[model samples]
Target: MKRSLDGFPKIEVNTQRKEGKALKKEFFRKERDLLGEEAIPENAYWGVHSKRARDNFPFSKKVPPSLVKAYFAVKWACARANLEVGLLEAKIGNAILKACEEGMEGKFNEEVIVPIFQGGAGTSLNMNINEIIANRALEILGYSKGNYQKINPFDHVNLSQSTNDTFMTAVKVATLWQLDELEKEIINLQETLQQKEKEFASVLKVGRTELQDAVPITLGMEFGAFAEAIARDRWRLWKSRERIKEVNLGGTAVGTGLNAHPEYIARAIVHLNEITGLPLAKAMNLFENTQNLDVFSEVSGLLRSLAVNLRKIANDLRLLSMGPRAGISEISLPALQEGSSIMPGKVNPVMCEYIEGIAIDVMGKDQAIAFSCSSGQLELNHLGPFIAAHILEMIEELKLGINAFTEKCLRGIRANQERCNELLEKSFALATCIVPYLGHERTSELVQECLREGKNFRDFLIEQKIFSEEELKNILNPLEISRPGIPGFGKVEVKRP
Candidate 1:
């Protein structure tokens, strides 16, 4: 095992080139000239990344999977887009597509070592993908790795594109893809709640006291509210998708389209859309697209909205399933893991707690993305790297949060019918249902008498002989009286028994 001068494990260099290969000699000369005595190894294209960035910002672990996916997605989209526009040859486009297929099939693992965080606003990530794809294509063609003569990273893999356009475009494409999955899950959760609502629509309980009766409501109404909130969020996400569709492809190198054929830009967009089946369009104004990252900010805001609703729903679940003995206990959540080491049968809302924490992280990432977008200056966005990192992080975190909330929290939640009935029977909140029939004055007097004399409102009315038992039962039918789906109402239909 070779070791660095500082005593750490040194990276080994492997090359397919034979001794005295012309390209290999040229690479060594360039390496020595670029890096001097402490030269970057001839085999390592990502030397700048490892030697500089790895030790400086050691906070994040290996590059996140989502960010990796985004990098590949951008490369794939750019290749196809360039091919369609005729800027890149069909063979190059085909090679990029092949590389993408291999990547999707898990070809590149940890072996292709490149740090996710680097300087130059994602230039390292761009080069990493280019090098990987070029090398992979070379293998397919029976050529040596890093042999640009056969498959050049700049001339072939990154043909007619720049980090500015490719990186930003890839971010948009990847985010849109994640949002598509998110929308589906959100819809599924909403439908689940709606189904629960329809199932629990009939059962009712007494209001004000066990002795006094009050208006009624079905259990489904409560769950339906949750469904509606999720649906609204889904709509917001759908609207945000449009913002991502307008990609910054073809805006090569500072959005000038300089040194790029007009046909190349148009063809790339067409090819990208054809390959991905995503509604991607060539940016109308390349300069603005490259310089402005407002679209990412818009997408982040929508994601924040989603995270906010997720937190709200999780909090509600925790409260609704608080206690089987002391809290609301109106619902029961499916217990997954043991909650305590010593306490027997203790099951905490662990899934909800996890989801809440994930949402908080997403919220924090949203702020970071917002700041990155604002940091962009003239001619080119300087914060593309951070924006991509933050948004990708947000996507993965939200995906996990949604899945856990659905499977662990929503799927496992059960209405505590017995507890709901017990609470409804003891609540005075149903008094508003009676004011229409008895007049406000009489209703107030009856409520005060019941409270002051420690008597049930229904019993007090019956004892005073103000209404017969049959009429009282008809008026205070808890099931029928609470039937008003809309909140803040006075009259409840008296169900004749």
Candidate 2:
């Protein structure tokens, strides 16, 4: 083995490969398992199980980076418990602990390569980590990478754990942290929208029902509604964490705890919670915990609700800021980039479109998670890898989309006050303000008569002396009509002769 100043064999790989050329590696180390023996790269940290998985499931999908980090946290905690319970030898246990601590910090994420969706109910993925840690533990103890004789991947690193319990525990831990990140971003978006609500508090615009003008509304009200919907989503999402708090890590394969020591089982979860600082609990009904994945469905439902609100709000923004000339240009989003190639000076609401795209994609991921959750077998939910992949992807995409929507689009939006006033000027919905002065039946009849005559309702109000010009202007003031109570009810009394 090649030696470095650290006294352990130098761990380095040659990666300069041309299109048709092979990776120029200088040495190889042989390692074997139940399947067979194989020559692994001398300096590479991964071992035979990882190599076999690489060849078998030839997909670009690696375990989600977050899940890798979380998986190693599970390993680290289990190893600690095993050491305390006299299962792991002292020196080797310390080496394994150091390796796992590094893994938890994401030092060896590149080694956790496997298809995000794979067979063996995630055993291949679990072994990949075990192999990496075992090799690294060997290297740490002044031995070569493939010298599993010094510290074995299965017998030492995975001492009291099974793929079923460990993988799902990692998924839950990773999801808890992912939820924390996403919740912070949601809070950012909610606060920003609230600020915009205050900024546009009095900018009046036409309120639409089914895309038809129905009443007067302030632009602030629109933003307020968006903020409120996100607030509800934030609460629901925060509450949804309760569903995944219970983890079944101590229950080995099939929830039987068949190979795990009772002392290891009791203390492992405690160490795990200490390492992760999450509200983790061992499953009371181990079988249910192993086989039931409906918690994913519940959380996905909450995520879908948020996606729906995001889609609706973003689409509304797209429509509200549609055009600077011909469309409903009542507001202007930040002009991010050139919207068209052939057309000159055409700026579209691409940010809103981007957010809408993310929302739609997240909705689809939620559906995929639903199906994956339902694919569980009798003793264990074999689809955790698939479910976890989509959940992590959805969370990352949502965080990115929400952050973009907040800074690039939502914060930079400006209410076109003049355009808002112009829209209400030609409107008939302003006639609703007169309903408090005139009874509903009389106002409805008069509105129908004006529509039939193709005459302006405000002009007719003045011509018929139902109201003076000043009185009509005051009664139909966009700002006044948009506020609570009847516009000009007490102030402008009808001058009836």
Candidate 3:
């Protein structure tokens, strides 16, 4: 019954109880380098290094759950490799493997207490994982949780592995897993856009450049471009898999595979691939793979491109759905919530705005990742934890944003046919339909005349006797002008006298 500043009890293991009293939980002393022996809770599935990390780096409550699962997978693969090469005994290896499998299933997650950002190139996180798995494996073997003499975290659980290789490999594996979800979300967004494209296929609207009406285009075609951009993002997400698939799992400390069996080094990645069910391959040049983190930077660039595309689409949506009374009002977005506290019925493009914010965050993370990747020196890049944190954040945010946009906005959009036709009728750029026959100079003269007189282009064409009503109707067909492939619209048989 004790309390700490964080409002949680300073937990102590129960070690003794007098006769007729229930026994208190027991604790054991664990010792390490530079730091002396300390009492670790007997029930807690982590060792002294983990406790040290919890005290040293109080940045966050914990790392991502995906990362924990990925580390479990890595440790299990290492155990398998160690057992195969006869470096670790079968009984201890089997127990460690069981603990790892359970860890992947989300067991022992409470033991992963270290913050993601720490010194030592993720050594603290790696040791924390090693400790958790080792303690849990010892418990499985009917020994105390902190009994390192019988089942040591470093000697048995972390055999044939180093923090540099294992942690980086785990980061890539976890990133790929998260990217799988991101890919699905991107595909969903693209499909929604394509559906909207088909729905608005025949809706004619004026296309603008520099905020000035330049020509005519269908609303469908505009949405089709959005879909195409998302499709490219989807492709980029898939392509990133190849770049990250090359991992350095066996290249311990400095990628020289020192203190690890040659057989263990050769087979460790094979076991990792089997465990993760990912197409992971060991790097041919372990040193380069361990030293250079450019692959993550490349993936970050792809993610940044996705954010840019998302921002463009969201901005267009905001513009298109500006106002019901005075703005473009070309399309109406679904009203999910009241936009203003004072104004009644003022619904905003909140979903698009939310997506825009997420895009900006993703782009920012990409820049941070690029800088972190370049900051690495010599045998290791200590910036991996930072890179992993940002990449995962970007993926999760984009996934959620895309899903919200698809469900709340894209699916519920309704085109204003009247407004679309109204704008097209008002746009003089439609005069370009007859430019081939009338020549640019003649078309320009007519356009200027219509603008100067404040007359609609259609009426001016009819008044000038350039063509009869039927001919003008056929020439200025909105759909034909937007797509511009009709047979006779542009074919001038004779010049107007």
Candidate 4:
């Protein structure tokens, strides 16, 4: 008998390629289950059940590592609860605890080769973890792989748990973890927007309604609006966290707690909160938690809102930075790459485009999450993993997308101050500002005259002496006109010539 350098008895799964050919021979240990026997790699920590799952799930890709670690966390909590209730033997439970601790650190994540998409409602995933922890615990106790006789996967590591409850619990826990990260990203972007607002606070530009100029505005105020939108999203996400913290653990196999001990079920939330360091709570009604997935759908709805806001913000930036020579080039984004292969001196708002694309992708995934949540059957939602996949994917996409958008675009954006002043000067939209001073009838007459003569409203106002230079400056101040309350309304009558 031989042992590997890692100190486990030699049960190695290896392949050697010789002269462009696959391995000619290999070795494995035989493991048996209710489905009969199967050969597994002798040194591989995962046993027959994991092997069967990986074989069955040919199309399964990588499960999110967050979900994987969260699963480990759930199991660790369960083991703790089981030990407290006298359901798990101290010697064997301590070994399982060590194994679970390693798994939480991502030590055994790669060994979980089961595919994510399958018909078992994440049973394969649960069993895969169980097998890994069991075998690793066996090695810790001076045993070889496939030594389930020393520490059985289902009997010992998985005491007082069921796939129905544990997997869904892990999903909620994992989503919460990712949500925390996403909230930080949103706050980061929101802070950047606030910085831009302060930076461009005094910048004057033409404000538009329905894509047509309506009035004057400060560029800082527009960024402030973006910040406000993100703030709302952040609030919604924070509120949504409370809903998902109520997990369905201890509701074994349909909320009946059939095989789970009463003490374990009673103490489940306490252990989970201790392990995850979050304010996790047990479900108020385990049965309702077991079958109903409306909570997840609601969270997905918020994600949909976030995506919409991001897309809207990106589009606004794209339009503001649309043209350098002939377009509404009121702002300039940092150039990160070649804009065109054929046109020289050409640049595009690719960062804005990228953010918009991610938003749309998030929206599509949000729909998938909704569909998956609503598809649950009587006593279980077989689509927990499915919903988890889409939600986790959206969180990751938004995080990276928001980071890229802020770093590559928002932070580097420069206000085209000269261009903004030029557009504001050229546009007659400022004509709306003088209504109170000139009265409606007189203001319209002057506006038509300026249009007929092809003159700017500011120029015409100055040329016609509609107000004294002091009064005109006061009436047409971009900050004064853009703010709330009537501009030049409460003041004494303007000095008109």
Candidate 5:
């Protein structure tokens, strides 16, 4: 076997003809079955197929780092399983394990250069991983790069595995990793909203419906609703992991475990769970797992649901913090940066706007994932790469966007106490508070009367002598009106002339 001198391959210098000049360049000629004699960079660990893929899908720059690490974990587990079943040599398996361990520790991340938008049912991505790993393992064993005949990328690294099983398994693992972080971001956002809820608990405001005054509500209540919605999303996200935990790791090619030992199938999943620290299990029916990709659709639906919630929350923040002069101004968001060059002292809700845009993008990506996952043929889904890439992008975008909103906008939010009081005083919706004493008809009349005279509801009520000042104070208590479960509020004692 041709081996490196110091257990590591060094870049080789070669002469090439370029522009009729004798040019010296560093290259390595790696051969492949389909595309033979391709000149690769000498220092590159990836091989012919990876180069082809890089050239083919130049639009997508690279694969997600999480997926690359997850792929390495799958390979590491497979190597251990093969070695355990006496199918692989100890030296080769140990070297593969070392490379995978380094990969999991983020060592070879830069080498994961496969573009995410490739075809071939993820075969290109799998080959990219196999080539990088095999060449790196060859280096650790004192073998030269591209000496695959001796250290065989397919035979040694990808033994007992296929693109269908390993790639899907890695996608699931990567998604689980991303969801864990997303759940944290969701919880952080929820806690921040809850904190604001508590801070605004006593500040009363006029609630609106269809852009018209509806009833009395505390500023805390609105923020509390946002917190509750995020809390629900956090729970749903935690449960989403269970849906993807069942993997078809043992199902090769078409879910039959072809050319793979049955023992390897069973043991590989166990090792994967150990390596990934996720509660992954082999599917009860490998055929079903292999043929169907609806699990991604289901998870994407949950993410879509979350995106919808985030959009609503963001829009509410935007509307609530509309302006200091002519808008609702019930709440004020932190001034992130200068809003416009033309408008001085003006600040925009850029963080909320950013979150709104992210939510819209996530929803769109979810639609793409759902449609692509359904485009699977009989045996396998050709759109697995697209689905995986979209899902990971959604999770990452949500995580980053939620964290940014929490830190930049949510944490610094404050209630507009003066505005809340002014709007509440002018709103005739407070007539609903006295609806129990004087039925809906009389209350509506009072509301109409106050609106027609352009008089504030409190002033109108005091002018009518429906109740004395003390009685109005007791009747219009903000907490009493907005508190929950206070139905059948007996008649307020009215002292009339």
Candidate 6:
């Protein structure tokens, strides 16, 4: 033994002493009894999650922070629900609340690096939080760690609760929060598109390839379509909110509400509503809620549909803004970063590409959710953990998609007026609009003459003297012809030559 400069005792061991080996032996003996019990091994620590889960589900990356946040939200709600329902004493509720407040303030999330995939149906996750909360509460009560003497993880901290109920409740509460974020971002994107529509209302484009001055369409209509699509998604999200409200909070162990008081169920829901300020309601059938994850599946389906719609929009935007020189340049996307390494002037739709990737990720998560939901067996749904994990992931990705689309894509997108005008001027598709006014037979003759002579519609009309320049101009005006009040063949007086 030696003393350091600070006077603390230090034992300097030679190789012969084997001090490390002696310490390891002592520690192993102490931990042996703890490891004997299978339900909760005594030697377990907070950060040590199951490695097998990580190996099994390599498809999903580590669980997202949003999912962890949702976990906390659900725990808080559960504690509040327990208090409101009188499942726990007021003292225990107060202690749990104080512990939760502390837990929320602390860096407890550092322990959630474990794989979300587990054969125990999230029992490990439930225990992980339970142990953490119990330890924190013990500290709050001035008790030593691992002392079941003061606040037990099961009897006190997790009284009248089961992993089945708590996990599902957490999923709903977390999803509601995530959906709120998504709604705000989507609405912002919608508003941005609407403003663009109004700004470009009068900008017109004609059919260009046909070299026919086809009927006119304002840039506003294009942007307006984008706005309408997002608006519909917003409504769908709003409508789906109520479905998440039906939580199975009291269905402990398995939807039987066993070991729980009837009062506890009602109080839990009421308190949860108060704590979250959300309109959460008790499930009409706890058994169904636990056994059938159809609701989660349904919501996941809606999310899939949303992702598909988002991808479609992104694809259209990318196509419309394909090139400044070569492709169909109907719009100019906001150039965020350099698009190409070799092509000097190339500016790819990076935002759209990002959104497309997000959409793909969301779709993949949706499949995971569906698979997890389907894997549930009798009495209790074992896939609860995976469901929560994937759904939360979907929400986060969608949020990023909405934000990126708004900031990088929608904000930077501009109507390529010159390109649009050129394309419209060249397109012969406008021939259809004029056919309704010129009579089908005459329109056919005009189209044949233009095609045979490789001449423009205006040039051919002028050479044939089909009508005076003034009449041809009036008939070919895209804006007037495309308008609602435009006269048809019966209304317009035409002299047949």
Q: How does each model score on lDDT?
A: 0.69, 0.85, 0.85, 0.86, 0.87, 0.70
Candidate 5 residue-wise lDDT, 31-150, digit = tens = 566646576676778888888888888787578999999999999999999999999999988998998898888887787777898898899989988988898898898777887876
List of clashing residue pairs for candidate 4: 11-42, 11-43, 12-43
Q: Which residue pairs show backbone clashes in model 2? A: none
Q: Which pairs of residues collide in model 5?
A: none
Which sections of candidate 1 miss by over 4 Å?
1-33, 36-57, 64-67, 73-97, 109-112, 205-217, 468-497
Task: Score every model by TM-score.
Answer: 0.82, 0.92, 0.92, 0.94, 0.94, 0.84
Per-residue alpha-carbon lDDT of candidate 4 for residues 1-497, written as tens digits (9 for 90 to 100) = 45544444433455775757666455677788999988788768888888888888788778899999999999989998998889888988888889999999999888989877867789989999999889888888878777676789888988878999999899888889999999889999999999999999888899999999888889999999999999999999999999899988998899888888888987877888888888998888898999998898899899889999999999999999988888999999999998999999898899899999999998998888888888998998888778878888888899889989988999999999999999998986667777666677777888789889998778777787666667656666666766786666655374333
**RMSD to truth, every model:** 7.1, 3.4, 4.9, 2.9, 3.1, 5.8
**Where does candidate 2 have its weakest 10-residue lDDT segment?**
3-12
Candidate 4's C-alpha runs over 4 A off are 1-16, 19-25, 490-497
lDDT of 6 by residue, 373-461 (tens): 88888877788877877788888889887897888778877887888767755656556656656677888888887888887666576
Q: Could you give me the TM-score of model 4 versus the true structure?
A: 0.94
Better of 3 and 4 by TM-score: 4
lDDT of 6 at 154: 74
lDDT by residue for model 1 (1-497), tens: 45433333333445557667533332321211144423344344333433444545555445555455656666676667666666666766687678866764556745335555556877766766777787677666655454556677778888877888887787777777777777778888888888877776654543222434445555566677778888998898898877689877877888888767777777767766765568988778888888899888888888888888878878877876888699877788888998999999899999889988988888898898888899887787777877877887787778777876787778767778898777764565445656666667777777787788886555666688766667655654545555554332333343222
Worst 10 residues of 5 by lDDT: 488-497
Candidate 5 vs candidate 6: which has greater lDDT?
Answer: 5
